[model samples]
Every structure is written in C-alpha cells, then in structure tokens.
Target: SMICMNHLKVGHYINFGLARGLGSIAYATTAFSLGLLVDKINPSLLVLFFVVGMVLLLVDLYTIEEIAINSDAKTDTHISVFKFIKTYRFYFVILLGFGITFGASAMLSTYLINIVKSLGGTTSFYGIAVFAMAASELPFMAITHTLLKHFKSEQLFVVAGIMYLVRNLLICLAPNLPILILGMLSQGASYGLFTATITYYVSDHIDRKHEMMGQTMISMMSTGLGSFMGNVMGGLLQDCFGLSIMLIAGLIMTLIGSLILVVFSLKQLKTHAS
Candidate 1:
C-alpha cells in the first residue's frame, strides 16, 4: 500500500483518502459478512473466498502504471537505504510522531475486544464497535479535500495528533459502553487526518526519486514498528497496572508526540515572521 501511494501523481490526498475510506468500508463489510456466516457456513470456505478476492485484486493492480511520470522523472543515482536514513534524519522525526499516534491507536485496537468486555459489551457490540470505528472514516475522508482547503496539512497533522490524545483520554475516562463507543467514533478524526496527510507530508519533504523509500519509512513507523511497540508495551502496562492505565499511558505518549509537532509548527511560523 505504501509503495503504491508513492507512484500516485494525481490528486494524491483525495486519492489516498478515498482509497482508505473504501478499503475500510470493504473491511467492515467483510467482518460483518463473516460474523453472519460464522454459524451458517464452514470456516475453511473463508480461505477460498480470500484467495478469490486476492486474485481479483491482482487483476486490477495489473492495470495500474508502475511508475508515474512527473517533471522530475529523470532517473537519479541510487543510494542504499542506510545512507538514505543517515541523510534524511528529519523525516525520521516526523515519522516518529506519526508512530506515536499510530502506536497508541494500535494499542487500543489490539485490546478493543477486551475493553468492550470489561465494559459489559457483547460480542455483537464488539463487531459493531469495529464497524463504526472504520466506517466513520468514510464521510470525513470523502470531504478531506474540503478540509485541506480550510486547513494546512501540517495543521491537520497536529489536529490528528491531538485527536489521538483525545481518543485515548476518552477511552481512559469512559465509564460505560456508550462513552467508549464515542471514543471509537473519534477514530474518524484521529485516523482519518493522519492517514490522509502523511503521504503528502513526506512528498513535500523528500526528493521525488526517493519517494518509494520515504513512504516505506512512514509505513514501517506507523504500521510496522509502532504497532509492534504498542502491542508489547500495552500488554506490559496492562499486566502491571490495568487496561485503563494503558490508555493513560497512550494519552501521555500522544501528547508528547503532538507537542513536538506543535513546537515545530511554531518554529516554522517564527521563521516566516522573521
């Protein structure tokens, strides 16, 4: 997914947001269908269904252009990934902020079922919560361009970071199922803003030739490394303190990360002023 995003040279934000929303809708629909079929159909058939879906997906992907042509389409000298990292340290800081946002979100996602159970929610409630959280992305993403018109991507990134903090705080303070579900709905703002803007942010900062590596780096942070750390640390926190405490930890992490971006924004503003 990250690799594909770099190749997109059109209205990138719109394309990204629409794709993400559609993908989330597909995911939610699949979950709902599987829930309905769990009792009526054999589990093994689900594997066949997935294979069919993948084959169809491959057929579609075969139509897309591998490399997008742009003004800077000229080939450049290749550098190893290690050298690229050492050369572009600032990108890593931005990625780390996103990592914290995603890490906290991943922690919530990992233990969502348990959290629902703790709140006296049923299995149906769990499925509904997941659907709502994902489906919430649809409307926000559909209007993402409108959002960008009113707010800079950097400001939106800060909004996303703050929403990440807010979502965790809501979860931490949730006294009942309804409040927790509200927190779940907040994923629209938190997740939507981050996913929609991150690619554009990287595109603006990194060279066109290094597009693939740049997107890959962000993906590794948000989805790969961040998720891994969140799962491990969240489990430890849960074990040591409680699930609620883990949410508090998430709140703090998000705040610190968001603050970094806030400071960065301020510095940029001051530089412009000078």
Candidate 2:
C-alpha cells in the first residue's frame, strides 16, 4: 500500500482507499465464513485455510512489479529514525492522535465478544457484528476520494474522529444488541474513513524520500503500539472496574485524539493560508 501510494503511477482513479475498501469486503466475508466453518468443522482446519491464503498471497505478490528508485535523487540518503522524528515532530503529533483514536476504536473490536455477551447475544451474533462492522467500512472507504474533492484530509480526519467519538459513546451506552450493532455500523465513517485518508495524509506531508518511513511510523503507532496499549488497558480496566468504566475510558481517549487533530489541523490550515 505504501509503495503504491507513493511510487506507482496507477492513475487518479486507483487509490489506497479503493484498495482498502476491497480488502474490508474480503475481510468481512472471511470473518463471517470462518466462524461458521470452525463451528461446523474442526478448528484445525484453520491451518489449512491459512496455508491456502499464504500461497495465494505469494502468487499475488509475485505479480507486482518492483518500483525502481532514482539513484541520482536524494531518495538514496538514509535518514536516521531519530532525525525523521525530530524533523517531522508536528506530523508526529498528528500521528499520536491517530494512535490514540485507533487504539480506543480497536479496543471495542478486540473485546466485542464480551460486549455481545453482556447484551445477551450469542457467539453467532458476534460473528454477524464483526461482519457488519467490516462490511460497513466498504461504502465509506470507496467514496473517500470523492469526499477528498470537497474536504481537506485534515478536515476528514476530524470527521472520522467525530464518528469514532459517536461510535464509542453509543457502544458505551448501548442497552441492547440492536443498539450495539448500530454502533458497530458507525465504523464506516470512523475507521473506514480514517484508514483511507491516513496514507494520503502522510504521503502529502512527508518528503518523497521518507514516504515509506512515514507510512511505517503510522502503522507502528496505530496497529502495533496503539493496539497493544488498547488491549492491555481495556482488559485491565474491565477486570478491575467493569466494562462501563473501560468503555468510558476509551471514549475519553478518543475525544482527546479528536481535539488534538482539530487544534493542529486548524493551525495547519492557518499556516497554509498565511
């Protein structure tokens, strides 16, 4: 995705968001089908499925042409991680917001079974909920490029933040399975939009030479560190305090992230205007 976004000349119509949307559809299908398969068959079948998937992925990878970097360009110069961080401190702050919001949102997905049980739902409902959440991402992600025509990426981040805030808040207060499912559906605008915009955001702001680094940094922050923190903290909070307290904590973190994005984005808009 980083390589395609930064290097490939695939034309204006082909974008990271479109690719991500298609991936979401595939994920939704897999999650729903895998749950049914495991319940009806032996769990060990998962290994076979994974092996097949790996083989298919390898075949797909083999078809991709390697992007050549120009040696004469400054793209060859190696920038230290510390140097990259120092130079792009402001962007790093935005990335911090991404990390926090993504973590909070991810906590819900990680502990979704617990949430379903609390609402008197079965494991089947959990599978359905997962399908709903992932499938909902597709439409919003598909139209992200269209949205970009009218709004800046920073502005869309704010919108996505608001969606996260609403989604978490709904989950926190939901009293029934239907309401919970509705909250899950809100992922279309939150995670879906955020994921679609992030690569473009980093590519636009960072230098070409550091584009891959920027993408990696965002992935590390959001998927790696952020997800780890969310899972650990959410579990601790749920065990010690209760599910409600943990959810409220997630909401607060999301709010902070949204505010950070809003404040910094406004500053960026002002700077650009001036």
Candidate 3:
C-alpha cells in the first residue's frame, strides 16, 4: 500500500482500488481453479504455482522506481509505538471502527461455504458466489476516484460502514442460495469502497515518513487481528448456537461498528472544520 502511495503520489486511491479489485478477481479464479485441479491432478502442483507466482512478484517489485526522501526531512520514525498511538489516538479510533466492521464482513466471507451449504448450495455454487462478490467490486472500485472528488474520506468511511451493515443484514436474512449470493454482491459497496479509501485516508493524515507504519497498522488491525477474531468467533458461534445465531452476532457487531464510524467520523469532520 505504501509503495503504491509513494509511486502514484496522485490518484493513489484509484490505482490501489484497481489493484485490490483485480487481486480479488485473481483470488476467486485461482481458488476455484485450484479446487478443480486438485480433484483431477496432483495437489503438489499448487506448490509449483506458488513458487512461480512469488518469483514473478519479486521481479515485478524490482521494476518499480523507489521514491527517495530528503535526508533532513522531519520524521516520526524514532517515536515508540506506544507514543505514536497516543499521538494519533483519533486515527486509532477510526481503525478500531474499521476492524470491528471488517471483522464481521470477514466472518461472512470465511464461512460463506457453510452459509451456502445451509441454503442447499453445492461447492460449484459457492465458487459462483465468490466470483460474483469479487467481480462486483470492480465497478465500484473503479468509480471510487470519482466519489472521492465529491466526498471526504471520512464521509466515504461512514457510507462504507452503512453498506457493511446492510450487507450483513442481507446475509442474515437470506433464505436461499440466490438470496445469499445476492447478499455477497454487496461487497462492491462495502469492502470495495472501504479498501479504496482506507489507505488514502491513512496516507493523507500521517506524515509521509510514517506511511509504512500507518499502512502496517491498518493491515494488522483490520485484516490480521480483525480477521482472526471473526473467524474464531464465527466458528464457535456456529458450532454452539447455529448459523442463525452466528449471523445475528455478526450483524450486531456490524451495527455497532457502523455507529462508531458514523459518530466519530462526524466529530472528525467538525474538528477539522473548526
């Protein structure tokens, strides 16, 4: 993310969102293809593909020009993590909101097959649903740059939060395979928008020298930590109470997270204005 921000400098969000959307498409395609290939061919083939992909990525990384900063530029890199967090407490609060909401969304994604099975969907349908979710992201992500022209990143975050809530609500109420797949399509508005804006928001708010830390914090909180919580809690809830209860719990978390984003985002805007 920091690399993209550094290289692009302008229109970073557009390129970032495009890359992320393309990545999702690649994920869906690779996962589905691998599932089929494993059934027909040796599973060991996966390792070869993984190694090839890594090599290609390494080569690609070498092609990008590195942006150099002035030696005398002011930097906060010397600060302790604790001190940094204390200084950027407001941004941390926003990150918390993202973590909670994305956690709920991640839970849905992680357990999508289970949800599909409950609705009598086959693994093929699961693959189709995944594709739908991934493909749906492209158009929304493509338009995010235009959206940014009319709205602040904080404002976009609130909208994304609302979309996350709605997406979860649809999933919770979905009674059939088609409805469940439809709910997955909401990824366009929810995850797509959020991903498009989040790195941009962090980059804009923090010093350029701290961009790497800010981006890392986002990944840790929203994807690493949040996804871990969601996956674990989702499994436990589904095992203990059942799918309905699990969905309800996710929905509740999404609601709380959305409310947090909305309230705090408005406060943030007001502070900036004053």
Question: Which pairs clash (backbone N, Cα, C closer than 3 Å) in model 1?
Answer: none
List lDDT for all candidates, in order: 0.77, 0.83, 0.83
C-alpha RMSD values across all candidates = 2.8, 1.9, 2.1
- Candidate 2 positional error at 58, Å: 0.8
- Per-residue lDDT tens digits for candidate 1, residues 1-274, read 4544555555433366777788889888898888789668888878888899999989988986566555655767476778888888655666787788678778888888888998899888999999988998877676665677677666776677677777777776788999998888888888876777766666666777776788788778888988998899999999999987898878877777777656665565456669
Candidate 2 positional error at 130, Å: 1.0
Which one wins by lDDT: 1 or 2?
2
Please rank every candidate by TM-score, starting with the best.
Answer: 2, 3, 1
Tell me model 1's lDDT, rounded to 2 decimals.
0.77
Deviation in Å, model 1, residue 121 alpha carbon: 0.9
Compared with the true structure, what per-residue lDDT tens digits does model 3 show for residues 21-114? 7888888788888989988999999999999999999999898777754435555466666776897887788888889988998899899888
Worst lDDT run of 10 residues, candidate 3, spans: 6-15
Model 2 Cα lDDT, one tens digit per residue, 111-168: 9899899999998899899999999998898888788889988788778878888888
Better of 1 and 2 by TM-score: 2
TM-score of each predicted structure versus truth = 0.87, 0.93, 0.92
